[model samples]
Target: MIIVPASADTERGRPGTTQQFADMQAYNDQMLRAGVFVDGQGLHPTSRGARVTWADGEWSVTDGPFAEAKELIAGFTIIEVSSREEAIEWLKKWPASCAPDPGQHLELRQVYAPEDFGEEFTAELREREEQMREEAARAAARG
Candidate 1:
């Protein structure tokens, strides 16, 4: 399974507070019931954020109250699904509400697991991971 996190554009997201919250709650409940949701959240406006960079043993921090809507991430979700098609199917229902404008976009990406590292280290890592999971399952059953 892969987990994907997505966000809406700051400029074109939910416009009505009461209706939006209701719609979002309903959508979240549906996904949770279907066991497709791993975790998710909405974010505060961009003005409450900051940016930092590090290079060559030095660090720089910028005060953001970001000026651009495109620089902000409005919300995110982690979903478990079988394939990219399935992931897109899930994403198609996102935003949970109609956008105030037409430019909203959701970014989809696959979460990396040990197996994505390829045959070299992945083979051994996957075996170890399976063993760990089995052990954890046995421990949970005992408890």
Candidate 2:
């Protein structure tokens, strides 16, 4: 599985919020048709959220309601691909307007499944997972 992180530039976007959502919807539709993405979602601004961290015998908490757009994490997507090359290919097709500017960035990372741990139980777990996914796919197709 590949994870794609995306953020919107609320400060410098040219097409306005409505247009940005429309563009995102269109991009999602294309991804659905491509059959590579397993799931995706857009997120609310950081102003509505908070962050928590732990230190040496201490807990630190920060309130949201932040105004700095650059520090915000907007949303993410998970894609199932055969290889890194395929993942990169799909990422290259991400909509251009998703970012605030040409330098705006997206981060892609590969997710580790139980099988990656190389434990005896992980083998069985992976087998069961594959079976469940296949069953779910068949069910979706029938519906």
lDDT of 2 by residue, 1-143 (tens): 33333245432222236766787778778878888767876566565567888999888988775666555556677887888888888777776656544555676788877656677657678889889989999998999
lDDT of 2 at 77: 75
TM-score of 2: 0.66
Cα-lDDT of candidate 1: 0.65
Report lDDT per candidate.
Answer: 0.65, 0.67
Candidate 2: count of backbone clashes, pairs at least 3 residues apart or interchain: 0
Candidate 1 residue-wise lDDT, 69-137, digit = tens? 553566667888778898888767754563333464667877887767777766677889889989998
Give candidate 1 misplaced runs (Cα > 4 Å): 1-16, 95-100, 118-143
